[model samples]
Target chain A: GESVGLHLPTLSVQEGDNSIINCAYSNSASDYFIWYKQESGKGPQFIIDIRSNMDKRQGQRVTVLLNKTVKHLSLQIAATQPGDSAVYFCAETGGGATNKLIFGTGTLLAVQP
Target chain B: GAGVSQSPRYKVAKRGQDVALRCDPISGHVSLFWYQQALGQGPEFLTYFQNEAQLDKSGLPSDRFFAERPEGSVSTLKIQRTQQEDSAVYLCASSLAGAWRTEAFFGQGTRLTVV
Candidate 1:
């Protein structure tokens, strides 16, 4: 997510290495959390999602960790590939119907070959 | 074999012009959503539809921005008197149900540039 203020944080990593992108959410009531990968000019693609009930969830090469006490979330990608280069976003769903998503400040992942 | 499909993948318009973006959600999906993504930001919700009924539109930026899903299968987002700030990629997504089991599928999105 781009800051309403200015500029987005960036993450640089080498191919075949592990990459970790972190986010700090503002809402403590946010129960449903999701991680989305957005490439340039494209909509966010769902990477994986985890509920507040669990602390960790793992996918093929990706893992999401949630720390409710601190309202923090993190996505870890193993063996990062060039294809992984994109903006990573963490979304939260709270409040009510429509289940609108509130996104966090995004991190741009630049993978070096 | 089909995901959400959006029309006119790209749109360029002068300020004060009117623009319409179209989205065709997957068949049988009952929930539809519209979101706007600026530059490198995460998508911000604009509106949502459950079938032909617009359940929520509070996210719409202003009255100039309107959306309709009359048939429930296809939806359209119209921006009147487009401003430079309206330039962004509009995305559409659909989901079957929200019981925390079904996933939402998103379209490629329409890139709107208001010069």
Candidate 2:
């Protein structure tokens, strides 16, 4: 069975500091990966995504690093803010016909001001 | 309208009851997906629809769960004889294309509580 799991259940960081969340996926066939942020009582919001062809992708204040050799994915947030406090989930999808996403257990990020 | 919309932000149902959750995807979107999320857990795939065609429903939990996208825009997920274990948040997402490379936008989600 394919599974995606986070290295940490929760991560606490200072508001002005940087935060890094790690994820491990078992499916090497997964070509598309996405990082999503979910606040309380809200749905998973897409933050950044990277294809297997690329090792790193950067957004406004976020970055996603994909390591195919180790089947590891990481999300890095710069200058973490209170508003960035939420549960972060990493999802993966392959090039199958369905292309349904497989999500990992989320990592709660708490920003301490 | 602007994004994926789900009706009944919260639902409370007694055991053995039936419930239906609705999802209105963004206009012109070709792909619609349904996921279930438990407390403190990531969303799990339930089903997926592409232009009224159910491409994949292997993620459906059991036979009690049924989803339909009649016209390819609005979808309904119906649960029969619901159980306490069915309590969770039902999320709907839509993407412009059905390909894996496209990004999907999610709705606020409907919280289902079975007592």
Per-candidate DockQ vs. reference:
0.49, 0.51
Binned by DockQ into CAPRI classes (incorrect, acceptable, medium, high), candidate 2 is medium
Model 2 stretches astray by more than 4 angstroms: A1-8
* iRMS (Å) per candidate: 2.4, 2.9
Those runs of model 1 whose alpha carbons end farther than 4 Å from true positions after fitting are A1-6, B99-102
lDDT tens readout by residue for model 2, B42-76: 88999999999998998899999999999999999
Candidate 1: the clashing residue pairs are A1-A106, A2-B41
* Predicted structure with the largest lDDT when compared to the true one: 2
Candidate 2 on A53-77: residue-level lDDT in tens?
A: 9999999999999999999999999
- Name every residue pair that clashes in candidate 2: none
User: What is the Å distance of residue A18 in model 1 from its true position?
Assistant: 1.0
